[model samples]
Target chain A: MLEYQDYILTEFNIVLLSSIAILIFLIVLLIFEASKIRSKFGMEEEDIEHRLDLLRHLVGAGKAYLFIADKEGAVVDINPDIQSLMGLEPNQLYGKDLGIFTEDTPGSNVESLWQVLRDKKLPFHLQLRGAWKNGEEFMETAEIRPLLAENSIVGFVVSRIGSTDGEGQSAEGSEELEKAYAKEQVIVESIGDGVIVTDAVADIVMMNKAAREILDTQESEIGKSIYEILQLEDENSAMLLPQYHPLAEALEDERRVMSRSYYIVRNDFTRISLAVTASPVIVDDGIVGGVIVFRDITKEKDIDRAKTEFVSLASHQLRTPLTTISWYTELLSGAGSDNLTDEQRNYLDVIYDGNQRMIGLVNALLNVSRLELGTFIIEPEPTKVQDLIMSVLRDVQPSVEEKQHEIAFNSEEEMPEINLDPRLMRMIIQNLLTNAIKYTPDKGKITIDLSRHYPDLILKVSDNGFGIPINQQDRIFTKLFRADNVLSKNTEGTGLGLYIVKSVLDRAGGNIWFESEEGKGTTFYVTIPLEGMKAKSGTKTLS
Target chain B: MMPKILVVEDMEAIRQAITAALAKAGYNVLQAKDGAEGLEIAFLEHPELILVDIIMPEVDGIEMVKRLRDDDWGKTASVMMLTNVEDSDKIVAVQKYHVYDYLVKSNWELDDVVEHIKNKLKAATEENS
Candidate 1:
């Protein structure tokens, strides 16, 4: 068994020796595979080297001065172009502070270029401004950006652009741009209307001669705040201003106010009425400023006033004779002991009614004149709408009874006493109620509703009358517009009631609208803003 | 005695109509053509109620009232303005003189004018009593 064990051991040793040799061979092959893979990686390094060479050639050849700085702002590398631009070699700038180039800038602090990179945060990645060296002015535009890694700034690169353009040198495109700019400047200066340009902070930057004369300002207005030049009109002041008063809205919201009339109380004590427009000057950067244009409209205003005065005078002169005719007709009705034929009585009634219609037309014209002339400045007194409506109803009750109209007045919630011109409120209700009485068929239903429309007092008058023709609806508030359907139905209408109502409401800063369908019914809505009334205190009428 | 109401108007027809209406309505009525004559009639008649016009020839109603308000008879008299002139200053001035009421002549019917006077006179009587 021992000799057999020895032979088995020798065979086992031979097998083990072959296994060791195989392991050694595997080790050498593994080393060979590793070096082969390493050599392939070495080829990739040369590919990176080729890219670096291209970058070096591009940076060296380009006229733009390109430089990179380390985290400490010390120059790591700079292109050869700096030698020609700054008259300094790249070797001299190496290991130097970034502020060395800015030392020649008078009054500029020699500090970290990091300070400049942070201070002049160029919103569009580039900045252009005038730079001087040896008293020669050159337009210097540079782009600087931080090299960011993992959300934190690691390094920075600065590139000075406009490589070929020097002082007194211009490209063909730039020459054309300058020429266009000059033409535009001339056009702005020669504009007929007043033109005033303001910066973003509302400082006056430029004003043409027309603007200076119209605004009663001098060329010294430049650098002054706009509000200092023109004061805002007070809301309660009875100033004749267009709906859009001042340029405040234009500047704040970017709304273009075109041909809006406003008053400018000049230093010379003359109130100049100007129609003005304001538009914002927006560039690629943002809204940088605003441009305002204005023109004097004093002549137009005077002509409008003259027209109103003539209408007022004509109406008053006509009303006197009409009053006499009205009284004579009332007396000549053959009432007491003077019996008349039905024919005579009918003729007298016709004369009286015709005179009354003429009187109504005259009164409406006078009211419109008053509204236009600002004579109807509100003399607000605490008035209960219910009481006013009831009084108006009583005044029109005779007509209502004659027509046999069924009127319903509803006010569920009692409203507080509203501050309003009692006369104006009375006229509004009277016109609406009288029209309802006149237009509706006998025994037709008329409804009135008074309620709070929240921060407003709303009165809605509805009548089951011959509704206005839909085609003529838009012209219902014209000075002498009458709907054809209404004109045919009721020949007595002056067509001035709604116009007078509209003018009165507009002067009071209220709104009037209506909804009507032909042959169905008509509902007129009136809304009075309660904001001014609630806050008003003293009477500021033209005394 | 019945209340003596005076009608002071510049328009002749308006004056006569108002006077006739007031007389028919059972008030003793005195008539005047202008503010000058109205003041004279008001002083002599010492009417309990006076209806005055605003714009007149010799003395305007506002000026006449300003003069009459100093005297005792005019101080106690209940005056109402019946006029075509709708001057806010005149209206406010009349109120300042403690006028009873202001009626726009063109805006009122004859019956409404009479009714308003009767009601106001009745209220004045009630208050005085």
Candidate 2:
């Protein structure tokens, strides 16, 4: 029985060994075949590279620019056209990060996108904001495709298809290049947002499907001036002046222009609101053309208008009850208090206090709502900041005295009255002062300093109060967000003061920042341009 | 003679509160429940100052003011807009008709309103002199 089992085991081993040998032989054959196929592909890649070199040489004599980057996004080579466009010497950009030539656009992570495409070995088209070495801004559509060899990515060919040096190129060379890029027109057609590409003279060169659909144009709009086809108008349906036209501004200034307040009158005699972004396609340090991207925002405008109306109605309803409560509370506190007991009087006082808090919240809500609605008007006039601050201080003198806080006011001796919205300034000053008075403990020191710093007037407010908690400081400017330290110490804060101040400053092209140390103190710095606030015509003013 | 002021607020509580406060401040105060009654009283009595609410039943404050401006006696009459609607269009509209002051009612207390009226009337009196 043992010999029989041994024979069976030996037979099984021989069978398994033969199977393994055969499998190894097959694997070696497959590897050999793969290498052979790889070599064939390598030869074809060399042929394609030669052809590309020939093509690049041919295109070098034209107006177009060509840029090449390695797999890791380092610039490998750039044609002479690109050299002149970027104002760089020959071979100067080699080994440098290709991102240096690109501007950082909001909401796009170019680094991660490149990493993703490199890993996937995929081709992608991107709307690139290209920057010249001389700090000139331009826009272009860039096609980045992986240079593949033996089924692996080796490098990238970054090609942009647009006439850069407009009139200098041979017509034959440009026509050949245009024909080569005809296939890419499918990509532009597939984009959802409306796109209109124009030439240096603001004449339309290409209009995408979405653009035609949005503009309600059935006939081809090609060769027509973009201004004539777009017919962008203001809110009052008045035709936008040449200076106000975003595309014109982009081409003339060679900078990006964005506007959400533009309306386009369609062939159907209907007007639609548009959120438009126009960027100049600059090349060779010259304004070549512009690319205008627009989207219909009629629905968004409608929704915003409805929300504003709702808030307006709600505020009116809210204020009516608030007014009743406050006025009645006043009457009771003034005359009816003579017949009330001490505890009853205290309850009345509490009611009045609560009502006042509600009123404050309502006022803050109205201001925030107006700001969000874009209905907050800024009407600038020459105003003395010192006098405004003094008046606000006078109003809050009782509160300051009640808190026993020492106040100091300092200013430059020859401070000139600057153009500013007095009412808005008063609101900002009142909020800052009230916050300082309310947050600081008895006998805390508060200081106010006003000084000029060339293009800006700086106003500094410092308070030796319970400073913001370190962890909660980042959220202080967020709407209705109070710091943890302040929340525990004081319940009077509506948490809207800093937010309102920030929003107002942002709209007026001013800035506000703060330095705070937990358990130490807080200082807020505000800067407004000396050139003054631009007057914005809107339906309401911030209360 | 006490300077008369008309209170044309739709809210009874607000009207009575302002009227009582104004009376206490040594002014003869006439009360109206709505803009219609206020206009009738305003035309009949010709108060020195008319405190009108913007949003009211039947005839609104703006319409009332517009009609008031059509009359010679009411054209230059002092009208203080006392309402919760802080609309710029409404304010501009009232300004064209010469609204003496535009006050959002919730922002003022009974005492402050009385004080404001006293100051406004004093100024008008001085202007006349």
Candidate 3:
């Protein structure tokens, strides 16, 4: 019982000691909590004060304008940048409503931006009113952001946004644009030639008075398709292929189509020939429309036709009288008398041949005039090239025998009955063969080759005599253009032979070219297609 | 019997020349100053062969032939066109009358033309026979 009393006393003493220690610890904790409250409420702690100063300094150092709005929408904090930008002291702006930045409008863009952030609380575009450092009012862009605490709005933060597009469109710029537009309108209205504009899809956007008169269109044609408004024909009086439509082609290529000949049929069914130029109105976006300019060329074409007709009529008249003289002379010389001296016979021969040459020249001129006037009718018939070659050989034989030139003709393939104009083909053969014999030296070689080359017939006339001068080769086929070397040698040549040959070949859908070296040789290459000349043969043959 | 041929021409020289050439070739020839006289003689006297010029004073050759071809007698006779003009349209125009041949005067000598006429007449005779 005594030992139990001792143990109970000891345990009671230990419990008392523990109670005191717990009481002291509770008192110290209460003191610490009181000190923390004092520091926060009355005595500003040095570390926190320093940190706030640093933060202010950092905000001031930034290039961007900064501001803070409190929960009640009053300016709670703002850097010096904002104060300078707003032209107000901190005290003046500190308690003012955030609406001051929004021009005081209840629902201005800046206010709306700030209100939107109440839920979103993210940065967005906002335009705010502010004053310059000199107290002048100006507009600026800012990024408004909401300060949030657990999805509830606390305040707003704003920063100025910098941009490269600082110079907005100004009054002077817009005035200049207006003046340019007015000038363009005046030019479009007063120009002498026709001008028409169409959108990318070929809808007519505008047409000038000249265009209206030329196309015989009313303002009702505006917004109609260009193809729908104007009926078009090519220079050949045939409908244009879609790929060749000027506006369509210009729009597609974004390029200019210049001075193309076409005819527009007016409302009265009268056709007006015109030279048209079209350009795409390309902008920063892309090709928007096309501008077409045109001039009437019908009068010019009539003048040209009249000139060709005059030439044709004059040639025919000259030939009729020459023909009478020629036949009468031939009759007097050939059958009436043979008892003349050698000199007299020679004189008669000169007269006869000179008259023949004059007739030949007139005939050539007539052919050229007919071709140029587009009145040369093509009468295609079944033709044997071999027979034609043989006959031409007979006609040119006297010259060949006089020159004594060695000649060889090779037909690599049996020619079928090819469709061709026998008269024109005869001219081709005579011209080429006559040129061959005339230019060749005595005992020189001449080779004629005609062969079928799958859709074409190839004829090569090569001579091993006086070739065309190298420099003048390009001009060899020009009318009356005799080469320098041949010009000095031969005075009898009229130089229309090759020109006629080239024009006829071009019209007949054939090709002709020559390879010549001065003092060496000349080989002419000619290829005529077996077909397709019939369809391509339009009035373009004259052109 | 010698074949009688009618010649129509505007130029006296060409007309007399053709007549002389034909007479030398042993054909009886009748002459007309223009296409009107040619048409009259063509109907009044039935010549075996008729040689006509293209351009004349009162009636051109094309109009004369186009008119004479409407008659039954003018339709059957072997008519040959002898012309100095070489226009292809006029040549094709004269071809519509079913003439025996169309000849360009300058492109042939008188001797060659005589032979050509003889051959065309012979061909026409064979076709008729």
Candidate 4:
């Protein structure tokens, strides 16, 4: 019996030893698994840190803030740069919601976008007016990129790039803007014509390289008042007042202003004729700044002067011969040569007529040269429009009687004396009336109506004559252009009368237009400002 | 006696034509081819009226008028400017010398010029009376 008990005790000891060994093996397996899981979590943390470092490197020295949040947008970690850019403590941002730093923009909700990112694990961008703990705000462009772990979103990396005071852009957006700005700089610097940009008060904001060279200015002239720096003179070499500056006019009127008479004096005391145009920059219906484009036109002016001198000389040479013909023809037609036969008299009459036509042609050509050269002077005097018209009527009465046309003169009562160049006014009236009488059939109705329309003196010359053809009406005002109907009807017109009239009116800031039909008569409408011709000081008056 | 008139012109045809016309109109006429010769005859003869041409050799019409006005009688002398070229400088300059009329030669007929001179002489006589 004692031997049987010993065997049982030995079996029990072997079984107990095997069971303890199995428990020990299980504990060792659990320890190894736990250690592997801890190592995997450590790798994910290291990956997030590496990504944060990469984001920091990407932002460079830009005013940027980077932070990492959990998948639910709960702030997990932030860079220290947030303090300098956003005036925020990095520690305070930790454990807070990302919504604390960002506000929803119009048309887009940060919470909805964050929800979308969390659900779809996709990256998104938003513009934010970032709010600080003390209620201060900054505009920022924010990008939220999802952090992933093993094919599932783990967290988000939020980077905000913005200005501390004004509007801000994303890192990529800022880079693009810099590139565009550099391109603009290159274009402005490379232009050959002088360009100057001025602020609202006429202070120089930027000047291109060509502008600097033309003005003999240096880089340090920026920010100075443009009027003070740019010394200008008129065509007469008189000092150009600041009030007359094209830039001043452009800014005040908010319209483009152009003038070819401006002469800019450089710092070296040399003068250059400039054709300048100034335009106002308008933003949101308000004038913000101005831009001036100018170029040197001294050589052109010299060539133009030479052309005018040649025309003057040629006209003088031509007039001497014409005057001799006129005097001798008059002498031969007089009673002192009464012995001439009828046929001889008729031949003399024809010579006289041809000579008169030649004189008229020469005069017309001379007037055209003066008009085209822009050398005609405008001398304004206060004169009654009615009296001037009456005098013109008397002068043209002989023609009126010859044509047997009815002249209907209708004028506004109490017409005041308007400031106008009398010679130019006479030219305007004579051309219109004679054209009316010449083109109209004998005894056709010619009407002259003069009235005041406040800012303008309106004149309408209507003729029941051969009307201008519809197809050729548009070219009527062109120099040396005669309507086909007029060309067919009369051979006496120089085709320059209307051109001269239009040029005179244009120089005086007036307008001209006509209404005509194929069979019906034509009415010409002219509007001259009541204040009269713009007084211009020039060298020669229109002949 | 017929009114004495002086014709000064550089162009021979124009000067003779004007002289012949003036003589036919019953005015005693004096002729000079240029302003220098015209001034010599004017200061010596003291004609009643002087018709001066603007562009001439040696002395221009304006310079002749300037020197003529230096004499006591020349200040009020009847003078008319005959010019084919419409020069503003000469026109403006002649205003200071009391020129009676500025006639663009091509624009006026011989009869009109004669009539203008007759009317001008009559007006001067009336003013003198």
TM-score of each: 0.74, 0.68, 0.69, 0.73
Assess each prediction's global lDDT (C-alpha) against the native.
0.70, 0.81, 0.74, 0.79
After superposition, candidate 2 runs with Cα above 4 Å error:
A1-183, A198-203, A223-228, A234-259, A278-290, A439-443, A466-478, A481-485, A517-520, B123-129
Query: Over the stretch A340-406, how does candidate 1's per-residue lDDT look in tens digits?
Result: 7789888888888887778787777777787666666676788898999999888888888888888
How does candidate 2 score on lDDT?
0.81
Between 2 and 3, whose lDDT is larger? Answer: 2
**Any residue pairs clashing in model 4, and if so which?**
none
Model 3, range A1-543, lDDT digits (tens) per residue?
A: 656544533432344334334434544554555557556676446534433433342244332335667667788667553454346788987888977776533445555656666755666766677665554555556666655555676556665544323132333465677789989988997899998898878888888888888877666478888887765797568887666788788988888997546898888889888888889999996887888889899999889888878877787677667767777776667665677777877887898888888878877777777777666666577888888888989888888888898889999665787888777777888888888788877888999999988899888999987899888888988988888887777777788899988988887788899999888989998887876244233221121
How high is the lDDT of residue A174 in model 3? 50
Off by over 4 Å in 1: A1-79, A84-170, A234-245, A258-261, A281-286, A334-337, A377-426, A429-458, A461-472, A507-509, A519-521, A529-543, B1-3, B25-28, B126-129
lDDT of 4 by residue, A67-178 (tens): 6777677887665434443567667677888777677878888789878887767778887556443454545567777767676776777664332222222334667777
RMSD of each: 17.2, 18.0, 20.5, 17.4
- Model 4 chain A lDDT-worst window of ten: A162-171
Cα lDDT of candidate 1 equals: 0.70
Candidate 3's TM-score: 0.69
**If both were scored by TM-score, which would come out higher, candidate 1 or candidate 3?**
1
Task: Tell me the lDDT of model 4 at A496.
Answer: 85
Q: How many pairs of residues collide in model 4?
A: 0
- Clash pairs detected, candidate 1: A194-A211
Per-residue alpha-carbon lDDT of model 2 for A228-250, expressed as tens digits?
A: 89889987678998767999888
